[model samples]
Target: MFITLATLTDVPELTALINASYRGESSKKGWTTEAHLIDGQRIDNEGLAEQMEDPNAVILKSMDDAGKITGCVYLQMRGDKLYLGMLTVSPLLQANGLGRLLLQAAEDYARSIDYHTITMTVISTRTELLSWYERRGYQKTGDVIPLIITEKFGILKQPVEMFRLEKTV
Candidate 1:
């Protein structure tokens, strides 16, 4: 597998992959689906393009031998820390350690860029997901915030909350 920075040309595939892995029936194939609580696309092309254009942001893509994007993660430098988001792996490809590989790569990338900390927010109800991150050495910062709900991603069926998690890289 190979990891590379995503370009604007990747928006379509990236957008589709994200929605497939996080919402709708396709997302149910994996443990990461938010379909039970939200409905709609996880992200749009315009939003993804904007993320790619940010000088402090990067979307790392994991490609297979045949050049298919199997997984990806979004990272942005926020002050001294790297804020990670939008981690997605093909729903059918989850639980195969690809997510872990991508996560390690994110940490390595952050260190190479001189960042000492990595932080991210996980939905408060996503206990399984939070456990996964905790096992990887991330800890809750006790900072809770409203989960961002927007048409740019999807519509929430219920109130949502998030907890910030951090790890010193």
Candidate 2:
């Protein structure tokens, strides 16, 4: 397996991967689903493409020997820190440590870019996810914020809260 930077051209597969990993019934096969909490698409192709074109953004794609994308993590530098998000692995491929691998890659990437810290926000309701990040050395900063913007993403079934987690690299 190998991990490489994804370009805008990879949007189609990336979109399918992300949507399958987070939305709809397919996501239920894994522990990362938000299907019961949200009704609209997690991310569209255009948004993925736009992010790939951003100068400070990077989408790391993990692939097997056949070159199919199995996992991906989105990272962007904001000031002195690296903002990470959109981490997705094929639902069927979860629990095999792929997520950990991708996360480690993100940290290494941050270090390579001379970033002093890494930050990410997780949905407050996702205790499993929060615990996973905490185990990986991220600390909760007690910064809970409302997820108010709904255009890029969609409306939430319940009022959503995000917890900011940070780690010094």
Compute each candidate's TM-score over C-alphas. 0.98, 0.97
Per-residue CA lDDT of candidate 2, range 86-107, in tens?
8999999999999999999999
Across 1-169, the per-residue lDDT of candidate 1 in tens digits comes to 9899888988999998998999999999999899998999888898889889999999999999998899999999999899999889999999999999999999999999999899999999999999999999999999999877777688989989999999999
Clashes of 2: 0
Candidate 1 wrong stretches, greater than 4 Å: none
TM-score (C-alpha, index-matched) for candidate 1: 0.98
Model 1, residue 160: displacement in angstroms?
0.5
